[model samples]
Target: MQQDTVLVVGGGPAGLAAAANVNSAGYKAVVVEKEDVLGGAPILSGYAKLVPSGEWAKDAIGRMVKRVEDDANSTVHKGAKVEKLEGEAGNFTATLTNGESVQAGAVVLATGFTHFDSINKPEWGFGTYEDVLTTTQMEQMVASGKIACPSDGRVPERVCILLCVGSRDRQIGREWCSKICCTVSANLAMEIKEISPETDVFIYYMDIRTFGLYEDKFYWKSQEEFKTKFVKARIAEVTASGDGRLLVKGEDTLVKRPIVIPFDIVVHAIGMDPNADNPEISQVFGVGLEKHGFLERAEQYTNTCGTTRKGIYSCGAAYGPETIDDSIAQGAAAGGRAVADLHALVQKAG
Candidate 1:
């Protein structure tokens, strides 16, 4: 068993950041990631391509990986998860299925999150219609340098974006904004128009969320400036015509009329929520979880990472909805809190 370390779980933006911060504090850190590789959500987060910055999440996460690998006080475990964690506070042991356990003074949970599967709504015709694709699939297509209609292999003349398929609807269990979908979908719409100027793009949304700095400008630019069609309605279903085209049926609430539009390709910009199995992690640490299964702290203030159980801390998506910047900041904070907890324990022992 490895001794005298902080076991930072999950190796994405938050986990790696926590490890980096803890190591810099003169304490060793061990990062346990379930996947065979690091980078967390951004590992598959193809190309929402960073906003205002014009960089992708993949590029930014790459930089974080280098920092952690180069640090001597940090050890990375790919394809490893703590099947069992024992003891508490100043002395804890995490045993992996590989029959290895590590002794650590502190723990930080940064497990991150997963995306919604848009195909659950068969009416959207995700798998049924070759012209229909989910946001992640669209990201992959964009990254792969191809945007042809999946069925006909021709440059799409009309591309439609369907919003809230897996988000903000009571029919399905996922009923949250997913925080980043609106911006990402809007960003992609503009990018698509830029790439294929001849292609007509339409964005269907219930409400255009334009929070934070200059986000409204982005929404406006995509709608009015870029001439992307903005339809305020809830799409009921997406079907395919006999000729390999797609048909979308929705209610245009603004005009209060039922509308059916045909397009060469349709993209589903689904929303996201907490991971399904996050409750299992919460139970392991004896921490409180929000109704949505995200880790819940003491309040909105002092107990962010601190759990009901001492010596344990949680951050990033393990806690709740937050952006990349917020997650990194919390990771660094969690490291400080944990090191402080350990320093006090050492002082007591001496």
Candidate 2:
């Protein structure tokens, strides 16, 4: 069994960053990713631009992937899922679905979150209507450099965006804010307007929860420069017209009246849900889960990366909703901690 190696589950942004740091600290790291690719949702979903910095998502996340791949001490196992996890902190064994096993001194679970399936909300007409799509699907359209209707491939004259599709809704049992949805939605709107300025964009939301200093740069710029209309109301329902257009039914809460708008396409700003693998990973690592189903930290603030089980840590969306920058920072922090712990164990054994 390997003595000083680290097993990093889920080769997303956080996992790749963690592996890079771990390898830099003189420890071998085995990154196990269920998907064939390394960048997780951002890469798999075809995200074009990253928020705030507006850098290409591929370039930003690709650099981290390159760092991991370049490191000789870091090994990436693509298309591999953990089948079984046994042993304790300082010496854990992970068996992959590919019938391979690896032993490590510590474990880092960076399994990222899943997007809220818009299909669950049947009223949104996600799967039913050809023109209705989620933000991820819209990203693909934008990546193609043509924001056109899915039904006929015609340039859409009007586009409607519905925010908070699967988040902050008590009826769906997800009450907490998904954190990044609001900002991402706004960014998507700006992208749409950039590609097609003549296409009028309307964002329907309960509230524009753009946190931090984005008030001037991103959110405000979208409204003022891009002319993206922000509607302060939740969408009641979305119906499809016979001609392939969408009839968005919602209220103008500001004006206290019901408004029905017709658009060529409607985009749902979906939120993040707990990773489907949380339960399996929790059982495998012997870690606890928060009520909301994210990996439980020892403490919310002081111990964001420490799981209930020592030597097994968590970061990124696997821990909670956070930006990519924060996830990278947490990954580095976890890597540093794992190295320190392993060093102490080696010294004690000697």
After superposition on all CA atoms, what RMSD does each candidate show versus the true structure? 2.2, 1.4
Over the stretch 1-350, how does candidate 1's per-residue lDDT look in tens digits?
23357999899888888999998988899999888888887665665566645677678888898899889988888898888889888889888766788889889988887777776788888878778888777877776766788776899999988888777777877656666667777777887887778888898988877568637657877887678898898789898777768889999998999998889999998666676667787776667777766777765677777766777887777776566777888888898888887887787877
List the pairs of residues colliding in candidate 1.
none
TM-score of 2: 0.96
Top model number, TM-score: 2
Q: In candidate 1, how many Å is residue 125 off?
A: 1.5
The worst-scoring run of ten residues by lDDT in candidate 1 lies at 44-53
TM-score for each model: 0.92, 0.96
lDDT of 2 at 205: 84
Candidate 1 Cα errors over 4 Å, as ranges: 1-4, 214-217, 348-350
What lDDT does the true structure give each of the candidates?
0.80, 0.86
Against the true structure, candidate 1 reaches a TM-score of 0.92
lDDT string for model 2 (1-350, tens) is 46689889988888888898899988999999999999888898888898777888799889889999889998889999888888887888889989999999899889989889998888988998999999999988888899999899888899988999888988888887888777887788899999998898888988888889766677788888888988898997899777768899888999999988899999998888989888988887788999999888887786678899988888888887877777888888888778778889888988
Q: In model 2, which runs have C-alpha deviations exceeding 4 angstroms?
A: none
